[model samples]
Target: MTHELGHAVHEYVSKKYGELGREKSCAQAETASIFAEQLVFAALLKAETDSKHRFILLAKHIEEMIAKTYRQIAFYRFEDMAHIERTNGEVSAQRLQEMFKSVMDNYLGPSVDTTGVEFICAGIHHFFEYDYYVYSYCFSCCVVNSLYEVYKSGTVANFAEKCMDMLTDSGVENYCSALAKFGIDATSPTFWQDGMRLFEQELSELETLEADIMKRTYINLEKKATH
Candidate 1:
């Protein structure tokens, strides 16, 4: 919910303020999604008697969200890179389909059934409106994950007020610059690596839960494999 609200703010800023406004809005939107996920997940865990169970459930759901975000955005990144490499703007839809298909297969893994659905290059909402909007989710997730780490650690040093200020200044700078205030340099490979590390951290928590607890909380892991 907060995530979508952030996007709403982004749109408003972009339409009203232009490039700088758009960048700030995007950063705010990204922050919204990232922080909200953590806050809600933590609350859920605290509320559950089976903390371990809730942990795994939330972990898996978050994993799927993160994976999907990366998968979709990765395709956007590839497409953007391709456009940059191209000499002209005359690429065919069929060509785009083929490229997108490869990306879907690569990131979707092989577990979830795709069956006869040609979802790869069909009906993507961003296709018509946002050229590389999918990547924004991935980028935002990375920033969010990093920010959550600081916020949750209780070491952010006025992070709450700072984040609020960041949101209000949504149209003043780009995502990277906004994140920079938090001491994060999004352009570095370390930034990405740190984001990926969160998945590992989540997975480790999942593994511990599975090893000692999930059977007690969940009833259908094997049958509902996706869950």
Candidate 2:
């Protein structure tokens, strides 16, 4: 649903501004899609009444954020390292696997058993087919997150229309120029942090929910035992 909205917005915008360029256009579309997903997720969380269901939703949101942001950043770093190593000398398959494992472990952390996961890199077609493709996920997530913050601030009176206008202009103007109209400065150092803050907030909420759910479960178990 989110991706399609991105396409639709892209199409709608492109008609007005013309094709900006492949990379910028794709980035703009991705930004729209990710923003849509965040909005929908927020709406769903708000509507959910059951604690267990809300916890599930929150968990899924956190998982998705981690995958899109941290994991993709890890992949980007791994690719950078691999490319640099290739330039220095021949990187053996074993060495590549080791590099992949190191980066994966960095992102996945100690709790995630990454045993036998190194080989999985061989299956990732993007590593071969697309150059730095993983970074796009990170880029889009950050852009959308910053834009979503603007929307939530209630400062922009016509947020939807402004977004549409931004999309329309994206086809002609560069992403930074187009986003600037909506007061989003992608080049700012804080821009990425603005995006990351959304995930942090979601993770914090999820942690609280998990603790509450565990407490309720413990209470129920104790009640049953006593009865």
Number of the predicted model whose lDDT against the real structure is largest: 2
| Superposition TM-score, candidate 2 onto the true structure | 0.89
Residue 220 C-alpha lDDT in model 2: 97
Put down candidate 2 lDDT per residue, 1-227, tens digits, no spaces. 77688667667655753444323545666777787788888899899999889989988888888888888889988899999999989999999999999999988889999999899889888899988888887899888888888888888788898787776666566778777876878789988888889888888888888899899999999999999
Error of 1 at 99 (Å): 2.3
> Compared with the true structure, what per-residue lDDT tens digits does model 1 show for residues 52-171?
667667676666656646776767865675476456777676666656666666666798665533455567667567676667777777777778776777766889777766765666
Clashing pairs in 2: none
Model 2 misplaced regions, further than 4 Å: 17-25
Q: In angstroms, how far off is 204's CA in candidate 1? A: 0.6
Question: Against the true structure, whose TM-score is highest?
Answer: 2
Candidate 1 error regions (>4 Å): 6-27, 81-93, 109-114, 174-177, 214-227
